[model samples]
Target: MMILSWRRRRGGHRTTKAAFSEENLSTNLAIPTHFLCPISLDLMKDPVTLPTGITYDRESIEKWIETGNQTCPVTNQVLKTFDQIPNHVIRRMIQDWCVENRARGVERIPTPRIPVAPRDVLEICSNIMTATQRGDHKKCMELVEKIKRWGRESERNKKCIVENGSGYVLSALFESFSSISIEEHKFLLGETLSLLIRMLPLGSEGQSNLGSASSLRCMAWFLKEKNLSSCQNAVLALKELLGLDEKHVNAFAEIEGVEEALVKIVKEQICPKSTKASLMVISHLISSSTSSENTISRFLELGLVSMVLEILVGSERGMTEKALSVLDTICNWEQGIVKARAHALTMPVLVKKILRVSILATDLSVSAILKLCKSQEGGGDQQVEALQLGGFHKLLVVLQVGCGEKTKEKATELLKLLNQHRGRLDCFDSSMDFKYLKRPSL
Candidate 1:
């Protein structure tokens, strides 16, 4: 036993020396557990502490804050600020550990770069605003480029820029874009529009300012850009600016090519996110009571009903829901009802999504079908179409399964419309399932 123990010690020494050899060192070194961050489970080179007294690596914590979490990961307490104090002691201790283990192939952590301060961000933004107000396009562009670079560096810098009034400055710049007629200024206009998009998800006040006629028109120009990203950002910014206000909605509707641009964006299918944003903008515009008759007429002329039906078929839940909503709004108008009734796929898609999406989607589909069914001209043809497209079975299912009061009313009305024309279509007998069609509540 003694001989075997001595041989084991000798062999361990040989193994350690072999591991230290240049060819195999990388595989032998182990990082200390204390140096790893709790959130990422990796080495924490730049540790910082939150108000909740939890220390995390700077990058991870900043990203977490950027995602709009207000609570600390460890304590679940409200985070007063995303601004975390550097955990200098822990960072130094980690560095020292790396140094002590350097002979064993551990690499030392480099010093972290300094983050942008809020005061500096405020100063730059103030200068940009001043240049913008003075109509000094040259100086404004230079400073904007610098700030854009800083914003790209880290989310911390972006938060500082936004918190320091960069949103208002960008909005003001966008508003002034129309007046700058110089060819050089046109380039700045595109860059300014792109920057404003990056500044979204943070500024309601800036969005309100951007809803002005001139500013909205400027934003619409980007929708025609050859670069798909520019067009997407332009649409996204428009959607974000379109808060639930009649004034904003009306302003959007008044833009000349807004409807056409949205249709083009949807048809191109740039991406699902961009397509959804465009749909939302169109939905809001069509739904507004303040929108002019010309706007609704324009949508119908642009084949909006068929476009919405195309989107509803085999689309995502969100797309289906919003498309149904737009359909329902358009159907409210006489022209809209006519266009929808004329579309071949409208009733079929509407019936297909009745119980499949959500309660809201189901409700919108039923209401739209009812409008089509109630139309004076070609109402009988639409009824026959609905029954032929299996709407008869779908409506019976909705009635039997039960839905909201409004949905049930629309379903019952559609059934009555279909029954009145059942003899013409020659499908179901009138007495087949009369019990399922209960009278809707008043």
Candidate 2:
């Protein structure tokens, strides 16, 4: 497709004739934005060069090319530009780039860089501090010669943080954010957050040293900026970037509305996949944020309990481990969200799930239920029935069919719990395959 040259720039070239040129437009135009740029027509490199020896920014080319600038690649024509390019083209571009950048292997690896002297680094870090303090971010950035330089600078700045006063300067700048007009503050905060997030990653794989602790302080500070819409997004983006889903519990503790946002991500993104991978993330979050009782309660209200149960009994061991871990949080933790009160709990979904897993598989699950049953004077009669009718027999079989003596301890405890009704002793033992369970006294 042909494109008009730099409009007001010296190298600008405007097409004289018109022709339909978008031969690569995707087959799915109604998909909101896919058709904006034909996926089939990919530009491996940016500052796309044209057959006419002219080049334009990818975004600019996409805009003007859709306005009927379709023409021979060699000839300048006004075939298409905006009429063909829907208003959502920009949206498509961002989604496409962000997704592509996020997908592994799509990003090019940077070449290795030689190290700079520590004293030289200190001199440059001092300037970065001065520039950043004066709000000269551009000049500060120019100090780093390569991507690796960010780490070096971060380290140097951290070591002599007292001498350069970066911490004080940054804190002062952050204060200015709240007092400024919302729009301007947002823009400034957005840049500040972006820099902090990138600088905050755990140092490169197998690095000799860790990234500066000060960088973490900066990143954590950005996370605390939940008051701004963009900053909130930046914090979430950082969580995603570092795979620190669990960290948000603490990272976002002071940030208002983060719990709701995190719950939304799990409900919307994590649960939908239901893959062992997604469950891994959820499990990590549950473990990291041990005290998110409110969030865990929201999960059940969001109808996530069913999904968690399904994963807990699924064949994927990793997923089951994660799901069980989450269940343990709600059912066993000191401040559990899933209370022992089983008033209206008529459904046996949780029971069925535990029953489905191998006797050994529900080890933690059985423990969680046992913890739930513990009360002030100890579990009551109804709680005992809850355990029995809730299919606590899953562990009974572990005792009866003690082929591997897997739940030997658990089985004994469960039996003791059932010791309440000596007459009902037969009822509990009946569920077990005592014949196969006997692994011999030895």
**Which numbered prediction scores highest in TM-score against the true structure?**
1
- The residue-level lDDT of candidate 2 at 189 comes to 42
Superposed Cα deviation of residue 52, candidate 2 (Å)? 50
Q: What is the lDDT, from 0 to 100, of the residue 30 in candidate 2?
A: 23
* lDDT score of residue 48 within candidate 2: 39
Candidate 1 collision pairs: none
| Displacement of the residue 48 alpha carbon in candidate 2, Å | 33
lDDT of 1 by residue, 4-112 (tens): 1111123323355432455434344455665677788777989988877789998888778778888898788987777788988889988997678656555568778
lDDT (C-alpha, whole model) for all candidates = 0.77, 0.43
Over 4 Å off in model 2, which ranges?
Answer: 1-128, 137-251, 270-307, 310-319, 332-363, 375-412, 418-442
CA shift at 366, candidate 1, in angstroms?
1.0
Per-residue CA lDDT of candidate 2, range 148-181, in tens? 3445544433343333333333333433343333
The 10 consecutive residues of candidate 1 with the worst lDDT sum are 1-10
lDDT of 2: 0.43
